[model samples]
Target: MRATMAARGHGRRLAAALWLVVVAASAASARFVVEKNGVKVLSPRSLRGHHEASIDAKLATGCDPFGAASPFKSRSGRPVVLLVDRGGCYFALKTWNAQEAGAAAVLVADIVDEPLLTMDTPEEQTPDMAFLANITAPSALISKRFGDALRLAAADSSSSSSSSSEEVVIRLDWRESMPNPDSRVEYEFWTNSNDECGARCDEQQSFVSSFRGHAQLLEKSGFAAFTPHYITWFCPEEYLQTRQCEAQCINKGRYCAPDPEQEIGAGYDGKDVVLENLRQLCVHRVASARNVSWVWWDFVVDYRVRCSMKEEKYSRQCARDVVSSLGLPVEMVEECMGDPEADADNDVLRTEQIVQVGQGSRGDVTILPTLVINNVQYRGKLESTAVLKAICAGFKESTEPPVCLTQDLETDECLNNNGGCWRDDKTNITACKDTYRGRICECPVVDGVQYQGDGYMDCKAVGPGRCAVDNGGCWKGTRDGKTFSACAGSESLSGCSCPAGFKGDGLHCEDIDECGEKLACSCPSCSCKNTWGGYDCSCGSGLLYIKVEDTCVGKSTSAMGWLATALVLSCLVGSGIVGFAFYKYRLRRYMDSEVMAIMSQYMPLDSQTTENRPLREEAVQA
Candidate 1:
């Protein structure tokens, strides 16, 4: 089922849906106040907060709809308006032009129904243009509705009979903040607006078309925004293929980091090739294997960590060396490296699997270094001890493995804060626990009595006689010359005791019958007898014990017969009443239909008959 789900891309689809569900919850909105006639009007703005730009002067439109410099500039220092149309000009260019023309800030009005967008520039730009693209002056995008209302308000004020220089003002105040990453992931306007291609289009006309399609798909899938994050690279023609592949990834709106330059020579190491081949192998093995525990432990947990910690560069040669060092597989590397199609397929498959695993983990892949045991992912800290605990908890066996049961197995938790050692039997507490501050052992309590306080957070009862409060059998000592019980010390706050009806050693007690010495049964009409640690009541000669009511009542077979008869009579009467009501309803409907037919035959169906008739009423009662 998981394989089928992965193949169908169910994991990515689910992750997208989940991200969208929490988009609003994870993101904050831009603070902008727009008022008309002292009443605030609702408007959507960019999530990126900028400096406040208040405009009380007449609203001035930029010379170009895209905010590019025109023959006429906006009134100096006045807020300039721009239209969200055309794709050729970047948002930065439009805003820069307005800024250069002395506009305090630029407001790009939406031409479509989409909410205002948080604009970003193209990935690659000239050095000088990049500086200008920062949008230093407060800038924002406003909805088409808000722009229209502002225009109408301006027009209304412009035509007012009373001449007042003061114009209708629209103030936009931006608080310092940024949109949430999840909210940015949910932006799907690109998919709807870019109609040239779909998410799964087979072919495209050009690179731009392909790039837009891929970006739209990524945004719709809640992966990233619809803008590429490019990394400039300097490479030779030999590695042009690599550049092309990386460009494809970048154009899809994914962050692309340039790989280290490859030096092609007669003595080329083929390190990159080997690393790629090994990655493909790992993905294939993980995908095909029925059990992933060994694969993760051997390759991911052990080999990956060792290689990373040793600063061993990940290459094809490094992978082969690691495999040889592990003393298992060198033949499989060649097999994996031989199939290029398999490499690509496995790459895509690995992505799907990772997303599936991530969603199964916690709906967030950012919490990395994850551990999955028995199909359940651990959401705790990325520590070996934490992982071990999760894996142990997944076991369903009656007996734990020897390693799991032994405290001799070293762990960082045990080394920290004198956590102390475990007993050979795993049930007994050691003397090291006497002065230990942390948890040492998980001692079991007697039946009917549970250990008080947290079991593992802090083993306050680990010291000598501390278990006395819960009556645990841990320690004992003598008071003066007399031998006292384990928890008889006045300083010992922890001890155990039997419940009301039980008695024995604190750690091992049994229930006792109190009714044997006391007249506990109060049922007057029943015979009482002691049973186990409790009592049972039985009805006397002519009575029946009703367990539901917990009482004895007079037995009456005749009364039962009467009740059965009454139930039958009631059911019969109810059925008869329903049948009569239904029959009456049907008869009334049939009679009404007949009456309507008779009336139609005697009288005209319309008032026109009265107007057409000459002194009607049966020709004056002839």
Candidate 2:
């Protein structure tokens, strides 16, 4: 009997040792540093929100169950991490209270000595618990022993008079929360298609809409690989034939979701959601096969907007319209989705269920819209910027993509109301410029022309090329197919002025009436008539108006006038004839001289001596 009892005692010891090994292996490895003594304590992150992996703040003890303690306040405007006991209320409520009191983070110390468990949002969401989705602070659960040490430190510091002992400061290091094994980051988004489920659903849709562009960018650049997932529950065998199962389960109770409106025989049933979920899953599969999986983001975003449950447009046809609009293979997706009436598992949805289970370091996906980066769950608000930051953190230190290093993710803010900046409706030119840091209200340079102004109210085109853009933002008019603008020639650098035929400020010009203003046709013989931009003038018969002198002259007539004109014409003709006769005589004399000179050169004439006797004698001597 003694030998058997000793063997049993040894068996118990061995079993306990094995249990410790299992617990240690499964526990999260994140830790925080106690600045006072340089001691490190294990504090695994537990909440889901935006975690500031690089956080250093002062620690304050506010053990009050209601979070009404004054110690929670930070006197120096430094970040305060509140330490609260674990049992006063729900874990989420504690964090909420701490958050309301302006605590940067909350640490819920376990009241009893036990293994640290993850603090999760409540299973059932209540109207008052709306704060769950808005919590941006990172939280963690620490061991009881460490909690005791922190509480003791807080007491000592508060009681002591030394400035150094006034408060305890620690740095919460979450750098290891996400594993960055390589340059490429692989992430998964667990979401649902039901948009009528309230805040969580709204958040999921918002995230998908806002982050679609960024996700597609990363995927196209090969910086990240993203997969989308949906969660479905299986109906129990006993309740398979019940009305609840009929309203929710699809494929004969194999997959299911809760009714969107939570009412029987009203609005959209839960099976509708399951079917849509299956369709979305197949969209990704079909797109992946075609090597254009990024289209999945487009389909999901478009479907959410075009086919929403609240709008009662969440049907198969609506989904097909979205699929077709994105140029996806509708038949292939239909084939992948299979039949929802079949009393068997869907190939695509079955795989989704298998992947939903925890593998490696990732835990089961229990929360709606959970983001898994590098096989580790991301904790933060479901915002595009926050989620993008978490994904960026998963890259190996220096291997982050350019998008990750940017200060802000591109939101395409210029799409809405032109980002509240000045715009020229006619030219479609805007002053809003979209950048990595959201939208900037600075004038834009378009087509080599720079705009100048405050950008928010008005932007005027400037420089030599300005006239080509919206006519330099100046007044312009068109009449009778003739268009006139206040802008000067392209060489004119800036400023607008009324043209020659119009008058007003540069922004608005009215055509000037030359006839009405008496600016033209002032001569008595001229007729005054106004045209669009100028005036027309006419003169009486036998009279001519000189435009340069702005006057009219009468035509001469009668016998005396005729005789004088004829005499002048006769004299001009006589002079012309005399000039021609003189020209011919001169030409004849010159030709005769040329002929005589040529004959003398060839043979001596009677009147011409061989040159001179002296010349002849010189030639003979030579």
Candidate 3:
């Protein structure tokens, strides 16, 4: 029994020696120094906020070391500052519950030999604890060495002093070591996340370029998210403002909380200026001139200021200066600088026109920035890459552009392989993925036809054409008595359509046979073969489709048949008419000669006739 007791006493002495050694080492590496009355103690850095709190309460070791207790009585009415060890629960939770139990502050001691660290509970890990916004009271972490020294001091005082008043009066003050600034430091939350990727990720590229300088500031600050301070101010509106904005603003005496009225402006509040510029340039100006992109590019690349938010006069001056500096066309500059609000009525009309046009084209089916291909709005992101993909899919004339085959963008459900294929207007052929069902090549089924493939492939073996029956054709309602299966990854069918061999609406389907009906073969007599939706006419040689009258009126092949037929008909008719006229004349002459002989016999030719005959014979002889 004596040997056991001796071993226990030796073990206690060794433990006490080890604690003293830890205290000596902590004093050397300690970064925070806490003071009470005149006694100074080393502490560690923990929690971020106002670095100091002053409370005059007798230190209390809560019933539970981690402060997980309902009520712990304090020796005085002064604010109670509890001494708690790190563990058992979240530091935030402990501080919060201790505060609820009427403690003014909770000082947590590290269990390890490491220096103090600010409490960090990521929401991803403890999803319920997003932020310690609820913790109003101050909480800090001190070194285990410091905690041990305090506990030892209290014990020593309790043993030596009177039994009724063995309490050590103390003060806890967190004095920050940062040098004082001339004025208050200000902060702002600004970002360029909404800047659009025009035609490409121009905005993103621009942001990447500008963010390079800020990388060091971010590293030094040791923040997970951007915290704007007074250091970063010159960044463009399209770029995020970090500490630089606040710093510059303060330097310029412009650092003030954003005025609500100023933020809520006249016509441009909450508007996407970059997107609006893209729309005006690509959709409007491009329609008029092919080289408009250069102007738009110059504006985005050179005009760094976001003048749209400025007052009218300043905006106009800035715009004019930019245009003059760029040496762009005067008319173009004038047109762009005209007051947007001055033409409010015109703006409304234009808006109405745009909406009306979109509605008419899409049958009131889609919203703004609609991606329509052959009258079908593509169901994809309104980004440059997605728009390019949709456009590439609509082309059935030739293979897709090289970019379409190789270009890849990060999609919501897709891991960008950066070497994938665009399948069709409706789907993209992406890298294979392991899904819940199984590993499968990523492709989409369109119009009831499953286009399963690993890489680049056609939407259909024989793609639809502009003239195809299903391309922009009116609804046939169903096919083969079954409902049309066009609902899958396709637009609705509602357009003009005609049956085979016809060239008009279904109601007025006029037969447009190229050979027989309209003599389109241009031959007098041609053999016509009617085919699906068309016909082929074989005329005798020398005959072809005539463009003049659009009729087949040629003669015989390899010969002039029409001319010969016309000659023969004209000769026969002429000869018959001549023969009938000659015969009538000859009969009339014979009847006249007989009538004269009968009259002469009935009435003697008078003597005057005999004399006239002799005279006539003499005159005739002369």
Best by TM-score: 2
Clashes of 1: 11
Worst 10 residues of 3 by lDDT: 1-10
Cα RMSD to native, each candidate? 30.3, 19.1, 28.0
TM-score of each: 0.24, 0.55, 0.24
Ranking by lDDT: 2, 3, 1
Per candidate, the number of residue pairs that clash is 11, 3, 12
Output candidate 2 Cα RMSD. Answer: 19.1
Comparing candidate 2 with candidate 3, which one achieves the higher lDDT?
2
- Model 3 TM-score, 2 decimals: 0.24
**Per-residue accuracy of model 3 over 1-622 as CA lDDT, tens digit each:** 0000000011121001001100101111222222211123322112111222111111211222223354443343345555566676666666666666666655565667763443533223344543343455554556676555544544444345454443433343221111112121111111221223122233333533444333223223331121211111122444234443332222122221222123434333222232233223322243225333234334433444444333322243554465556555546644542333341322322332343333322333222223233343333333344344434443332222333344262122234442244334322333343221112344444454343344444222122332132432232333345332221123222334455555655323444667556545454555667653466766556565544554455445315666788899999999999999999999999999999888987775776477678887889999
Off by over 4 Å in 3: 1-70, 125-131, 155-166, 175-178, 181-622
Across 1-622, the per-residue lDDT of candidate 1 in tens digits comes to 0000000011110000000000101112333212111113321122112222222111222222322343222222334333222233665665555555444444544555653333444435455554442344444444556444444443443345554423322343221111221212221110010111221111111223323433333334443322111112123435435634433222221212222233233222233322342343453353234322123123332344344312545445655566556444567545543443232333332343344322321232221122233322222222333333333333232222333333532232444543444332233433222211123445333343334433344333433444444334433333346332334334545555543444666555554554455445445775767654356778788787765666677778646967999999999999999999999999999999999888888777666576767767669889
For residue 293, model 3's alpha carbon misses the true position, in angstroms, by: 32
User: All candidates' lDDT scores?
Assistant: 0.36, 0.69, 0.37
Roughly what TM-score does model 2 have, to 2 decimal places? 0.55
For lDDT, the strongest prediction is: 2
Q: Which of the two, 2 or 3, has more TM-score?
A: 2
